[model samples]
Target: MNEGDDDISVDKNEDSAVLASPEVLETSFFINKPSKKKLKKGVFNRTWLNWVEYKSFLKEYNHDSSQAACIVCNQQFSVYYCSKAEIDNHIKTKKHQHHMKSYDVNQQLIT
Candidate 1:
């Protein structure tokens, strides 16, 4: 029709294109993230040390860390939060019960 209009003719015969989201974007955007674990709180109790043989100080797991360990079970647990409950839970475990029974038997024999 016009000088520039004649050069810009529509190409109706050409194929149409459909848009799709990329695989990388779909995975990253749609995936659910893992939940974070709860952290321990509170300081280790002073009297727990007396419960052991030394009866002087708790076997502090690490410096500046409120932690205690079960010598019978050979395991350490965080006491930074709810110190007594943490210890109680550990004591309630079957493994600790079994080991404590064996320890008592050994001690009686040694004496």
Candidate 2:
């Protein structure tokens, strides 16, 4: 067996992702081609609304979008990449608590 053969021991197949050589892999001169760049699309899931902690004020701002709205604070939050972390952080903020108290007071006055 040739010593160079060990470099490409992978089984050859039509659908194999292993490139034949480094030159073949570097055929494209462009550093960042649109086809190479991945676009991450986020979607606001309805199931997040069912969480006991978030159900009270968390809601979907748009159908199948990457955004959630806080009912108590009257604010919209992006849930891209990290969905629950963004939502839970917003709920834990002092501003949200203040808004919650104000909303409750306003509701009490109405009742």
TM-score of every candidate relative to the true structure: 0.52, 0.55
Judged by whole-model lDDT over C-alpha atoms, candidate 1 comes out at: 0.71
| lDDT score at residue 4, model 2, on the 0-100 scale | 62
The number of the candidate with the highest TM-score is 2
Q: lDDT per residue, candidate 2, 1-111, as tens digits?
A: 776665655465555665567765576545455556675755677887787878878889874478899999989988887777888889789999999888879888999
List, residue by residue over 1-111, the lDDT tens digit for candidate 1: 876665655578854564555986787665776667776467776667777642322366766567787777778888777787888787788998898889778878999
Show where candidate 1 strays beyond 4 Å. 1-40, 52-58
lDDT of each: 0.71, 0.80
Clashes in model 1: which pairs?
Answer: 41-80, 41-81, 42-80, 42-81
What C-alpha lDDT, on a 0 to 100 scale, does residue 100 get in candidate 2?
82
